[model samples]
Target chain A: MWETVLSALMDPVNALFLVGGVAGGIVVGALPGLTATMALALMLPFTFSMSPEPALIMLGGIYIGAIYGGSISAILINTPGTPSSIATTFDGYPMTRQGKPEQALVTAAFSSGIGGVLGGLTLLFLSPALADLALQFGPPEFFWVAIFGLTIIATLSAGSLLKGMIGGCLGLMLSTVGIAPIGGESRFTFGFSPLQGGLDLVVMLIGLFCIPEVLAMVDRKRVAKQGLALKREKGVAGGVIKKLVRQPLLLLRSSIVGIITGIIPGAGGNIASLLSYDLAVRFDKKHKDYGKGRMEGVVASEASNNAEVGGSLVPLLSLGIPGAAPAAVLMGALLIQGITPGPDLYTRYPDLVYTFIIAFIIANFVMFVMAFYGARYVARMIDLPADVLLPMIVMLTVIGSFAIRNSYLDVCMMLGFGIAGYFLKKVGFEPGPIVLGIILGPIAETGLAQSMLLGQAEGGVWQIFFTRPITLVLIVLSLISLLSAVYIQTSRAGWKAGRRDAETCDAD
Target chain B: MRRRLNREIGVSLFFLGIAVIAFIQVEGLNRMSAVFPRTLAVILLVLSGILLVQSLVRPPEKKKGETPLASSRILPFLLILVLYAVLIAGLGFLIATILFAGVGTWYLCDRNKIRAIIGSILLGILFYALFRFVFLVPFPGI
Candidate 1:
């Protein structure tokens, strides 16, 4: 492990990939409406020729850098660059209005850096044990795990559960487009010859995530003429380090919250930051300062969101399950590299795993250095016209989709999915669950088929799910996940109704 | 302003059609090939039906005043994308990319013609160099 770490550090090529990924990620995250998932999707084809270690190292840099980069626009323009930075805008924008924008920026950067480092440490420590436990899982357990992932889509669609489930079903249906996994028979090719190989995951990813952003940009071009102006100040970062040191507990607690949330499949950085901010507000003596230029609020939000980077990777590395949308893209990257991430990942490629983990830690530090010194210049990226940016992204998306298999069918399929994604988003359905469903669909299907084959030999199909202890645990987790999503939504509605009733009584 | 319930009903109906088509297609397949797709199709069908019913029964939520980004508005851009995909096959990678970028930049930003053309050409060259030289991805010439 030490040798691999040293090799990664000494190698110029590894450093290059890390630097490039971090720079690109920061730009993507700083751009409004661009996401880490889209960036990964656009770049996925580029990693096709790369060795697994370098490919993952580059992705890790992008993941960590993008999470931190979101706070830049959140502080300066009151627009969260990524969904995760939504909480950052609460206090971050207020500080900008107070003429202390630089301070808020520094606070967010430093907090994110600390949080990222802590999350990386948790991943390094916890993943091995998790992988050990996952080794005990059979086909039935795997099926249950996939079901648990599908259930989390309910949580993804908090506002519209029915729509979200439909999106999941859409994804599952699409996943069945090419050929049956077990039977080696075409199911839904519609007589199209090119589709026998299946809808390329990279094509769907770019189409669904990137193309919609471009279309949205064209639509909003008429409204986004005015740009945010940023003024840079020196010496603001020095004080933030001192403040971060003073509030070690807040940083630790927020990091813990982020990691835990990230470990749960489908709960991305946005949820982590929101939960962390709530906890911070509850414990803060300066509660009134929240949503009003409070440094702690900025710290709490940034820390947790960045921390989610490490936490999300834990599941991807251990259980072959994606912890978030970006992680799902990473899992695809791994599959393309012919490296299945599970218990064998630790045994077969320990050195490579160590190298990737070490690179992630190094990337966080690199992000810290770049964000601290180059934020003023980086903030200018926000000013680029949507017209120019959209066209450029379109060209990349077109090229990226075509490059997957050098097929026009893939490109056309991407456009079709892109159009579909745009309509889906218009009606309040998120693209995340759809993407999640596509990624997990095959895993669930294959697991179920394989489990069935094994169960027939063991007397009965029902016995497989009931007899296995691991399967039982997974089933319970799945139920808990699904029930809690519905429970939370109903209770929130009831609470709002009660509040409205009390207000009416008070008025009377 | 469009009502949320109306939009929901429309979406649900669209998905319902998709589900019914999927279900019909999988009907003659072997059990092994049909089980997964058929199960998902049924789930989608049931869910969309529930969504349609709920949308019909619920009171319409207050409509927001902002002009939502409609897919209809972006239909022209989608056509442009289709044209680019077809053209890329005829013109090859670099030439098609340059043409698309230059023309697309001009189309997207109508006022700054010269800047758009030059900047887009540079962008095209940059992408070509990055993909061909750095990543070594294959792109056929015309």
Candidate 2:
């Protein structure tokens, strides 16, 4: 572990990718419409052709960086670049109104850095134990785990639960397009020979996530927003840091809130930050003072969101279950690298796992450094014309899909999915549950099928599936997840800041 | 503005069709392969069925003004994407991208011939070089 950490730190290429991911993620996250998930999806092609360590390193950096970057727009422009920073606007924008934009930015940056590192530490320490526990998961347990993931994401990620489940079923059907996982027979090819391989996960990812956003941006291009001016002030960051250092518990509490929220599959950073901000208000000496230019508000919101990044990765690394959408994309990256994340990940590739975690913590520091110095310039990226950004991203999707197999067919399929995804989004089907379904489909199918074969000897199918202690626990959890999502939707009149929407799901 | 289909009713019917198609298709597969898909097909059918029934029972929620980023150009933009993909197979990656980017920028956003021409050329060249050189990604066409 020490050797891997040292090598990751000492390597120039690793440092470069980590820094670049951080800077790029911050810019994308601050762009309001662009999200960590889309950024990760766009960055997917870049990773497929590279080795595992650097890919994981860069993705970790981007995840942490983008979560913090949302706070920048929240502060200056009164818009969250990503949904995760919606809470930041409460006090962050007020701070901007008070001529303390730079101070607020620094406060956010500092708290995010501290929160992110703490959260990464939690992942570094906790994932091994989780992996050990997951090693106990058999075919039945794994099947239930997949079901749990699909249920949680579907209900939490979409506005309409029925529609979300339909989307999940759609994704499951898409996953079946090529060969049957267990039977090894071509199932849904519909006589298209090329589809015998099914859709490329990366291609679908680029299509489903990127293309919809590009078109959506085009639709909104007419509604223009102007940014507020940012002035550089000396010692602004220094003052914010010194003040934040005095309230260690506040930062720790917010980060804890973020970590716990992140561990619950569908509760994303937006939820984490809101819950943290609420807790801060309850404990704050002047209870009614939050959302009125309180630095603690910005700190709590930013810290929890960034920390959620680390907290979210724990499940992805240990159980192959992504806690959020960005983590889902990260799982795709892991798949691209020929690494299936699960219990064996710790045993088989200890070096890559350790390097990724340590590099993740290091990326937060890099993000802090870049955000402190380059926040103003990065804010200017939101100004780039949608026409340019859209076309460029379209080109990226073309090349990104093409590069994976050097196949124009994949590009066309990507475009097809993009078009379908656009129409799907128009009708309120989000990419979150679809992506989850696609990821979990193979796992669930193989788990159940294999369990069926095992049950031939172990008495009966019900005994195999329902009799296990672990499977029972997972079944109960899946029920709870589905019920809670239903209750939350029915109880609340409106969803705020899209707690599990595409962007906020990656707000992890 | 053109009259639009009732989204709730329309989406439910569309998904219902998909569910039927999926279930019918699963019948031709081996029993082993069909089991899982068959299960999903039923789920889709039931879910879409529930959605349709619910849509009929409840009044569709009235949409508020300023539906975030609503636009009429999506269908036209999708046509552009199809054209772009087709052009890639014939025109080759570079030339196709140049035409797509150039025309897309000019009509879609820039609306300035000079800037569109220059910007598209620059973008086309930059991406061509990156894919051609930095990544060494092979383009299938000329």
Candidate 3:
């Protein structure tokens, strides 16, 4: 592993690609509406022809860079470039407004690098052990794991539980459109040949997230504004280092939150960022400064979100289940390279895996350097005119949509989803749940059915789930998560009611 | 009051109708068909029922204001996409891309005619050169 890592570092071409990928990823990520997933999807054709090591390295660079790039917009403008950056805006914009934009940028870079390095190290050491344990899992255990992922419905639901469940069910129904998993039977093709393959997840994501956003932007006549001008400081490096030393615990706690959330298959960087930000607020001695521009908030959000990249890959490498949407796309890229993920991945391609881990560490380092030097220029993107930016994005989206498989059907799908997304948003349905559902739905279904079939051959459904200790443990955990979500919602409602009653009494 | 109730009822009826249609489709499938779709359809039916009931119980949130200009602006964009799709098969990637980029820039950006034309032509050539010379993507032909 050490030799592989050494060789990867020594290889000039690999290093060059890593730098290029990080740079490109940062540019792509800094652009609003150009998601990391879209960047990977657009780059898929290019990566198809490259060697597996360089390809994986490039993709890894993009993943890390894009995750960090989102903070640029979050800090400069109020809009988060990616969903994961939503929490960053809480403190990032406030910092910008306080004329500490450079300080915020430096803090973001430092925390992002620290979190990323920690996550990469976790992947390096823990993956082998996790892979070994994963070797014991069969269809039954996998089914339970998928069920556990579905249990995230409890956490994701913002409104009525029933509505969330209904939305999830709708997502499941959409997934059933292509073909039957068990047999080769075409179930819901509706006689259209394109429907045979069902809706592509990338198309679904682009439609659900991007289309609605573009429509909203057009509606509001939204224009990008020049960010708060700050005095050019020479000591950004010194400032970042000083803050790192001062907020060691905050960085550590946020990184841990990011890692744990990333390890969970359904909870991606978005959730990790939010969870870390919430914790930072709770832990801070001066909580009043939280939404009003605290450096701790910036550290917590950026560090945790970047850490999720490492966390998400753990499941992808060990279990063949992706930890997030972009990870799912990465998994697809891996499959295209003829590299199947699971226990065999460790045994068969130890060197490549090692190379990937080393490259991830290198990618974070590259991002740190880029962010340090390029912060001035990247910050300027916040002021780009929407009229110019939107058209360019639309052009790219069209080209990307068409480029996949060179199919016009995909173009049509993109446009259709764009319109559908616009309406869904207007109706108050969040696309986050929908995107999660689309990605996870097929995996959950396939696992459940296969496990049930195997169980019936053995004895019964209950025996199948209960017999395996690991499955039992996962099942129990899922129930606990569901219960906890319900408890939180109930307590929140109670608190709100109490506050309302007190206000009423005071008024009277 | 009547208008609001009418809209809710219409939405509910539409979903219920789709559920019925889905159920009928499922019934037509052979017994050998997997249990998953049938199960999914049944779930959808139940969901549609719930959505229907909810619509009746609670008035839909009244959305404020007119639709965004982008929704209307999308038609021209869609036409450009359609043109690219149709022409790409015949003209090949390079020509189709050039045409798409050129026309799309002019139509969507709202730039002056000369600027639009120049911008489109430059974008086309740039994409062509990058994909062909740099990335070796093999755009079809002239």
Highest lDDT against the true fold, candidate: 2
Q: Give the per-residue lDDT digits (tens) of candidate 2, residues A318-378.
A: 9988877888889889987889988889999988999899899889889889988989887
lDDT of 1 by residue, A64-128 (tens): 88888888888888888888998898789889889998898889888998999999998899998
CAPRI tier of model 1:
medium
Name every residue pair that clashes in candidate 1. none
Superposed Cα deviation of residue A225, candidate 1 (Å): 5.9
TM-score of each: 0.94, 0.94, 0.86
Chain B TM-score against the true chain B, candidate 1: 0.83
Name model 1 segments beyond 4 Å from true. Answer: A222-235, A487-508, B1-5, B59-73
Every candidate's lDDT: 0.82, 0.83, 0.72
Compute the lDDT of residue A367 as modeled in candidate 3: 96
Which CAPRI level is candidate 2? medium
Per-residue C-alpha lDDT of model 3 across residues A1-508, encoded as one tens digit per residue:
7777788778998988899889888877876666777667566556656788888999999999899988888888877777678788888988888888888888888899999998898888888899988788887777676667656653444444555554555566677777767655676677898888888765665566566665565554444556434456988669667868887889889999999888876567877888788788788789867777888888999999999899989978877767776787777678668887776688888888889988998799999999887867776665655545554454455555554455667766876777766655544445555665665667666766777778788878547867889988988978876676566457545644654674576579
Candidate 3: residue pairs that collide: A219-B68
